[model samples]
Target: MTAVHGDPILTSEEGPIRTTEFESIARAVDRETEGVQVELIGGRLGVKRVPDGDHGRILNWLLLLLMPLNPGLFLHVIGQGLAVGSYRKGRARPDGILAPPDAFAGAGEWASPDAVVMTVEVTSHDSDTNHRDRVEKPIAYARAGIPIYLLIDREAGKVVVHSQPDEDGYQDLHSYAFGRAVSLPEPVGVTFDTESLKDMGD
Candidate 1:
């Protein structure tokens, strides 16, 4: 479990846990652990493994492609926990959050999604990648009104760009294999090549 994307491990029927209790649990895990990230999505707890070297490489590759294209925007990782899902109740920490610089200023752990234009996720090697990255996330990001949800699916060996968010999920979708290029829609106008991912290992 070395990829950046969180591995979804749904908790057993622990009955109904309050938001305060969920936050307390997440804080304890984050404080005591070293290479784990906790998320409270859909009222269930999920643990994310520490990112491996390939994950770091992909992140750096993204930086090279985005910096020159959008100087006014920024991409945040690790510490940028987002308030996702309906009513901003669910907490999610994406691989990278794209927004204008200073969007998270004064926003503590879980920030609002108002300024978030895009959210990026890099799939891990775990079997839960399909459920977590492909299914749950699209709904959560859309519910949060994030304009774009970028899925770098390592297993699928493709880049799935989700945009045109509606109440349920993204209305528009375009997928490109590792060797192809990707074009993101507006509010975030940028296009890039994903050919280098061919060597990144699925």
Candidate 2:
């Protein structure tokens, strides 16, 4: 079996185990293993496959678009984690994140959501991955006071922009199909062209 990040590696003969604390996840991140991503969800460690080729392409496109538009802000891709909610109850590793350059200055392995201007997630092959990005993560990001959350649903071939977050979930949500243009609100003031985004298999 191939080794996936965040999942337990059987270093000893004791077999597989899951990390249950935020510190453990942080320590794993400090190790800096390649092709591995770790997220702390509801205080439990979760491992996921690194972003595939299509995911990387979309992220790069967004990075390029954002750099010219928001020259002062920083753009972070996969492997950068954000500490969400109070006391780091949840940690989210987004496909891409836009924030101030000093956001995590002198900070630890993860950054607080307060520092994030916007976050993006591209759906993976797993249904749970889809649900996390579409359902759970939005609520988490909202609760953490993140202003914008962009979910690229490869399975649905649509991009959903969520904003105006309150105590509940985002109050505003606009979705556009693969070929349409989606408007991103202020702070990240720009309209995104989803026409070039590749579908799941293509």
Candidate 3:
């Protein structure tokens, strides 16, 4: 991650509180404070605790399952931010994001939502996290015109594949339990195995 200069002071009492600007947040994301994830929702900043070990296991499994089918595409795990909307009103970093390798070749800091093919989010322990991933993200992803949004709801013990994006969110949504397989749509024509996801409970 490249260092971003220009410190914008948010408060007089605190020294240089980071601004909600996408670039500022992106620059602030570093190894020293990797546990806190930053996002721009409706042009406002929203922070959340990163997912834990079990969340990572499921993400890894998904990466392994998808990478082989489309070698030209790149699968980005947590930390990479995606800029969405015309005004760049929102910047979201999904649990997993799949896009063409050259999509952001020369771009700096973030990738536009138009370049994204798919996004995945695994539900976390917090209700706010659940609401963001489950409800907010789908709407945002759809409005931004992403083709697919896959969500692994750990608390609900199910996997949901959302596609056919429209003005009002995904037109198609398919839900399956942990052991069932969910078929991805065109551009990524494959069935994902959810058997291993059962281990997330352990």
Give the top-scoring candidate (TM-score).
1
Score candidate 1 by TM-score against the native. 0.91
Clashes of 2: 0
Q: Estimate each model's TM-score.
A: 0.91, 0.81, 0.81
Against the reference, the lDDT scores of all candidates come to 0.81, 0.71, 0.72
Where model 1 places Cα greater than 4 Å from the true spot, the runs are: 1-15
In model 3, the Cα lDDT at residue 56 comes to: 88
Over all chains combined, what TM-score does candidate 3 have? 0.81
- Kindly list the per-residue Cα lDDT of model 3 for residues 65-160, writing each as its tens digit: 788877877777846778763345567788888888677677766667778889888887764665577777887788788999998898888999
**Across residues 85-122, which tens digit of lDDT does each residue of candidate 2 receive?**
43446777888888887777777666677778898888
Residue pairs with colliding backbones in model 1 are: none
Weakest 10 consecutive residues, lDDT, candidate 3? Answer: 6-15
| Residue 3, candidate 1: alpha-carbon lDDT | 22
Q: Kindly report which residue pairs in candidate 3 clash with one another.
A: none
